[model samples]
Target: MTGRERHGTGARLRRMLAYAVLILFALVFLYPFVIQTATAFKTEPDAAAHPLSPIPDPVTTEAFAQVFGGTGFPLWVVNSLAVTLLITAGRVFLDSLAGYALARLPFRGRGAITAMVLAVMAVPGVVLLIPKFLVLNQLGLYDTYTALVLPLIVDAAGVFIMRQFFLSVPPSLEEAARMDGAGVFRTYWSVILPMARPALITLTILSFQSSWNEFPHTVVAVQDPALYTLPRGIANLVAGSLGAGTQYPLKLAAALLATIPVAIIFIVFQRYFVRGAAEGASKE
Candidate 1:
């Protein structure tokens, strides 16, 4: 073969190999989800007998029916929705403002505050559980929705993400806004924030995912069964809330249903999420 033809043939083979590897990884990642889905529709006997099977021999909706009818899953959904929405909104707004200040605003203690944020990020969150519980208890906020939502309103990682993004923006934009008689907040709201859509979307996705699947914080925040979120409820279900024998189908159904909202949101905003993450990475 000619040199060019040989090179082209090698490139095609490499491309084919790359695709084969990616497809293999995709299947590996998706296999568990496939099992969860099929098991959700399987009879208890089928699920237990064929735990890893991707096909349900005799399909059923009994597990789904029981998830809603025989458990606190509905209340868990409501609580999770309320808490996750509030936390996501709060983080987006608060993190953006804090990031802008750290990036652009010249204020006393700004450097120190940024350092503190970094330090907090380095600290393990599990270590804060006791302090969180004590403060919530001391303030009489424990076991309430307020306890669940308030402490998580702001996160160091979100602030850091927003800061990195804001730093990447050209200062000339803010300068132009200021020359047009815009104050700091006005400049931020009208100019900076609009340009920060990518980072905002990234933060939104992370915040939503984190708060939606949160279990540790919930353990310290609330103990009331009436106030349990999906993760806590799922944990309870796994620990045998259904009582008697193992209800694999019911447990998998609850988990499957719980995973849907985050999956749908991620799929819908996937493009924006990717753009945001790319921008954030390129910034610093």
Candidate 2:
């Protein structure tokens, strides 16, 4: 072959090799999820015998039935939904407000407050568990839904995300609103928030996913069985709720069910996540 033709052929071979490597990695990462799903449909003996197999022999759904009927799975779902929704809404609204103030508003102690937020983000969440429990106890908020939902309503990471995003927004937009007789809240509500849809969507997805999968915080927040969220309840299920046998099918089924909502939300809003992140990274 001619030089250019030889180069093109070599490039095609390299491209094919790269694709092969990527496909291999994708399968490796997805293999566990495949096991989880297939095992959920398998009988206990079948699951234990062919744990790595993606196809269940003599497929069954007794596990799903048990998940719905035998345990507190339904109650866990209800509690998770309520708490996650409230936390997502609260984080979006409150975090954005704090971010906007840090980014745009010129108040005293602004720099100090911004530094404090960043510092809070650097602190490990587990380190604060004892203090969180103590505060909850002192406020008479322990073991209540209020205890579950209140502390998580605002988060340092969420505030940092919104602040960075708001900083990317042009100051001229807010100036124009002010010139048109809009007050601070009016400008934020009517002009700024509409333009912030991409960032808001990103924040909403993160907040929902974080709250839904939360386990450590729930340990301190509530003790009532009725107050348990999916993560906490699933942990209990695995610890001893099934009585004696391994019950792999039932466990996997419950865990699989818990993942559905987050997966759906990510699939739906994935396009906006990249856009918002890119916009936030750029400065005017």
How would you encode candidate 2's per-residue C-alpha lDDT over 1-284 as one tens digit per residue?
A: 89999999999999999999999999999999999999999998998888889999989999999999999999999999999999999999999998888889999999999999989989999998899999999999999999989999998878888888888779999999999999999988898888889989989999999999999999999999999999999999999777988888999999999999999999999999888877776742
Model 2: colliding residue pairs: none
What number of clashing residue pairs does each candidate have, in the order they appear? Answer: 0, 0
TM-score per model over all chains: 0.96, 0.95
Q: Candidate 2: give its CA RMSD in angstroms.
A: 1.6
Q: Which digits, one per residue and each the tens of the lDDT, describe model 1 over residues 1-284? A: 99999999999999999999999999999999999899999998888888899999898999999999999999999999999999999999999999999999999999999999999999999999999999999999999999999999999999999999999889899889888999999999989999999899999999999999999999999999999999999999999976787798999999999999999999999999999888888877
Best candidate per TM-score, number?
1
Residue pairs in clash, model 1: none
Identify the candidate with maximal lDDT.
1
Q: What C-alpha lDDT do the candidate models reach, one value each?
A: 0.95, 0.93
